[model samples]
Target: MQNNRIRLLMLFITLLLPGIAMAASNAKENYGYYCVQCHGMKGNGMGLNIKDMSVQPRDHTDAKAMGARSDDEIFKVIKEGGQSISKSVLMPPWGDTFSDEEIHDLVKYLRSLCNCKLGG
Candidate 1:
């Protein structure tokens, strides 16, 4: 019985692990498709368009900077565009393109970039 239980637990974990991994992977893909041009693959704000833009993109990897903002603020900016938060209009609205769940996932991914957590 003990051996069977151990095997069952292992099987359960193996099944659960892929979903967690796939969520992260999907978030990365979303970031690459929509944000990499301005945020860069490394989230360093050194994207291809850096030279042309009047305002520098926020560095997602900047822990101190990213940590200052709340998750709701991040979500608002992503969904409604930076202008919604009185930021640069260069950050276009993605509300039309992505669902709220997807935007939340992106926010989570951005937080991961800086190793930061949203405060309550």
Candidate 2:
């Protein structure tokens, strides 16, 4: 009985460990997977596409610029795409790609990168 209980506990821990690790890395993982190509790994506007594109992507680490926008605005752009905010058509919509929770998490992660809040 003791051995069985130990084995079950071990199995539970093994299963739960991966989820915990994934949860912690979720924002970064999502950002890397989707945003990094255009936003860059460091959140700078100088992505690989910079040489190929006309308008530059927003630098996520720019506190001054990022501070002017509201969280709702950022969230909207992320969900509905830049065209929804009249910014650019290049920014594709991720509403179909990511869940609301994931979008919110990305917003929060952006805030962290900029070291600024939504509003002044």
Per-residue accuracy of model 1 over 24-115 as CA lDDT, tens digit each: 88889999998989988899999999899999999999988899999999999999999999999999999999899888889999999999
TM-score of 1: 0.86
Q: Which stretches of candidate 1 lie over 4 Å from their true place?
A: 1-12
| C-alpha TM-scores of all predictions | 0.86, 0.80
Clashing pairs in 2: none
For each of the candidates, the C-alpha root-mean-square deviation to the true structure, in angstroms, is: 2.2, 4.4
Candidate whose lDDT is highest: 1
Candidate 2's residue-wise lDDT over 13-70, tens digit each?
9999997667548988999889988899899887788788778999999999999988
Q: Weakest 10 consecutive residues, lDDT, candidate 2?
A: 19-28
How does each model score on lDDT? 0.92, 0.89
